[model samples]
Target: MMKKADVGDKTKTFHKGQAIYKEGQSSGEAYIITQGAVGLYRLAGNKRVTLALLRPGQIFGEMGVITGEKRTSEALALDYTEVIVLDQTLLHTLLLKSPRPVQIITSYLVERVRALNALVPERSSSNTFASVCSVILLAWRAAARSGPKSEAAQISTVELSRTIKDILLITQTEIDEVLEKLARVHIVDIVDVKGTYYRTDPLLGTKKKSGEFVKERLLSIPDAERFARVSRNMAQDNPDANGAELEFIDLDDFARAVDAQPETILKKIAYGEVPPALFHFHKRQALAFAASKGQDYFQRAKRPRLKVEDLQNVDDVVGVDNATLEEALSRLGFYKVGVLAALAGDEARQKIYANLSKKIASVVREEVQRMPEPDPGEASDIEDELIGLIKSIKGISG
Candidate 1:
């Protein structure tokens, strides 16, 4: 067990010779022995190998629970046993409530544990690629926030790793591999610098430096989006590889998935963008049934979304604060939905997403997905109306 922490009210009992949980079962909790003893074992062929016998006050299954991986070993009651179960939710709450220092240390420790338990089978490559994408994008975003945004952003590897590990259990090696891959493709440059003020110390009881530490690796990303796109192509090429996970918001794929040419998807996206497979299947079904009514039947149609610049007078709303827009939406009550609906397409959605909360964006997105395919003329009219409404707001510039 990582910490002999307080146990929640959840507990389970098993009689002597009873199996508590089998190896390869879905992992859900870290159990603290309360009474009697429990034996941890692994199976090799027909043989059952004893790993450890945990007594009262001891804990097991923390590895699987922390990594969110399946159980690697079976647990059996050596005698009548009772164990306190620290389920995932409770564990998360405990970690989340901890002080910043504790949280940071816990993150590092968790990463190490995950690395140690590498023998345990892991998740799909698509998931790893997603993580890689998130780390890179987040690192780039962090650099942008710290200073003026630039075409090439320099990010501290240590800071980036720490920040990402605090939220995700991805190991440093995984992240390094992603960056290295990006560097290989000329998407980023991993440089080593000396005498820089950035701290590169590992959190191991060392005194904090006052904005002065040696710089090990500084990541320079010329374009985060291109880096992300290349990552997508890498993941698509080898999705099951263990190295990286990428966040995918691919424009071209989305276009193809919706059964439209890239150019057609450029117009005005209708539904909330969905999973590639599911969206493709639904589009196929719709085209199959709806083709008879259309004059040109054989050509499959693609759902569309308009680029922000393509929207009528989109420049008028480009930098407007979301709160101001929300207030405007309230004023134009009838056009409020259409106002949000106009925020479609990769570039347009990026603008909205950058300035708004995900909850509000999701609400807007869900509504758009449910609406019928938008009329281009109506969409332009909605955009025009929305822009006019926004320009009327006081203290707004551009």
Candidate 2:
């Protein structure tokens, strides 16, 4: 019987055939087999393809641990085993804290790779076409994860070739050959001259839209009506509903309440009718759905109505101090005494003058453009008068 040595730090016992780590899972830690054997394998051709077997004093999962790559193989314990699990975070800290550990890890990985190569020769030539196909499939999955469905499903062979070449250090000719084999097997549907491939059927190699593929394609539509309907429905089902309820506001009610032009709301909703079941219609859902349609239902509903008191308040003018008035006028651009007097009388003076100033700025800009240079004397007089008018408006003699 082999004596089991206790590697006290980060060691855990696993039952026979128990999964230690799975492929494609986030690599949070690396493991060193201490007391038992472990098998590394990947799913290939619907069969478990054994990649390697590890005994005591062997390090595995370093590829993903170092590069932050996804795990490429599943590790299963051969029997009751004790393994040392090193935390990736701690490992990184250790690498930074001491250079020696980093050097040791790097050399260890190199030695492991060389040893593995002696057993399994780099997988460069064996079934090169199949490997290429695998690369394409990986690319497709990656694109689907990152981009819109329609974009992901309709990948060009040229693009796939470029990506494969970059990632796998393979030739375009090899990628092309693999693509042809993939197309021949019907794992991917190839569009002639366009180089587009769609995963039609997984097993029979039939070209068919996957559920996710269908959903993604539908969502990619500029105006997805199904999404809108579902969104609207979802909004209506909520109990603590704000503004007008969705059920209360029918198609006609929505149009009238919003005061939109004839057929505008109807036409917008009509465009979203293609996949009605796909969306959950709710308030937020409706808003998001109608966003592309340029409808502002919530904004219209939330618009506060002006009252008589509000108007009266604007008309009622209270005397403002000269310094305050002068500063406001200087910053805001008011020149004529008459204009200031009119503004002072109106309680909505700020609002009115703001609008007037905008117009004045536009006119001044045009005049400046027409004139080669402004008259210094005229400019000085205008400035003085502007200041005086501001002071007077505020009822200050200065």
Candidate 3:
């Protein structure tokens, strides 16, 4: 029988299929699987892939909780299970007081390390060091992000992979494959203990850190020069605009508008430092330049996408009864239905019948019947046409 002290803490119960904790959340405590089972999984590519399953007597989350790291994989209860929660502080204190506890923890950590080594391929001596460096760099960034708050100075593999994918413009699989190759050379250490953490020697070959390597690659792009030139030209043209104006140019205006700046604007621009052309800025160069330099420029504001809540309000106003408007909004994408419903008073609905087509209008009419009768100003025809537009756009059955 397990002693109360050996359990070290109280057991928490979870139903089958319930989430014990999600991936990416901060690790609060580790768990000992006292009864039932739990499955650990992470998002691999587009799918949730199971990394491991724990049965009775096995401990999980020790690596991350002890190290104060973010969870890499989600833990889901495989059945009605009871888990003994081991608070990091309390566990550490207990471990210090008891030789038996220290031994247990040491054995657990060793077993975990051994298990990870068996699962991951060993790094070889013959592999390209450059690729190995890249993998190590990514792994370092990931560990930095996922490490504890005190060591919060770390990055997680997911974040590192995302940055590399964006900078290198490669898929996750491509990044994973590169890491796998580097893992073969032992240049990068990939550990599957708790959340996957990576470690690498930055001084292995290159003097440059991973960040410097990525920055160098970015600066070397052919478009980098062109983007810089265009941005400088735009800045010169908008000499009157303040630095903030240049920095916060709206997307639409940034692409097309060009106009002279006022004296006051020029004074502000003089005080402001020119911002660097980063990846996102480079992608929207035309927009950024236009907003900075174009005369009579107006940046188009992005409209909020319509949501289910919008449809519910429309249903309340229109006298549509019976069917829940929320359900209808889901069937017809919210924005599509909301934009059409907004046209309830338009004159075009009545005159544009033949142009709009009957099938489209019929669906709109059916939906409107659920809502309350429109006010005197509301035109049923316009509402019908709006529905028609939605059906046409979504290819929904009229």
Whole-model lDDT per candidate = 0.63, 0.52, 0.50
Candidate 1 segments whose C-alpha is farther than 4 A from its true place: 1-130, 196-214, 241-398
Cα lDDT tens digits, model 1, 1-398, are 43445556677899999988888999898888989999886643212445578899897887677678888788999999998888888777777887999888877987785564453333323256555565567557556655775555687888778755543456889777777777788977778876534344576756554564455778877776687678778866645433322323345445656777764454333333443443322244357567756856546754333333333544334445667666655655333453455545555556654554566667666666676767778777666776666665644344
Name model 2 segments beyond 4 Å from true: 1-8, 93-398
Q: Which candidate is the best by TM-score?
A: 1
Candidate 3: tens digits of C-alpha lDDT, residues 1-398: 34558657677999999999987899888888889999876543222445678998888876666657687678999999998998888667655777887768776885685576343222211122232233334344334444674642433456566655443334667567655644453434454424233346667843433331211111111232243344344334323211111112322233334443333333223324224342133344358667786756555533233432233222222333223323334444333443445443332233222223366545555555565544534445435444444444444555
Please identify model 3 stretches exceeding 4 Å from their true place. 97-398
Model 1 lowest lDDT segment of ten: 241-250
Name the TM-score of candidate 2: 0.27
How does model 1 score by TM-score? 0.32
Per-residue error (Å), model 3, residue 4: 3.3
Model 2 root mean square deviation, Cα atoms: 24.0
lDDT tens per residue, model 2, 303-351: 2333222212212223334354435455544333223333233333453
Q: What is the lDDT ranking, best to worst?
A: 1, 2, 3
C-alpha lDDT (0 to 100) for residue 278 of candidate 2: 31
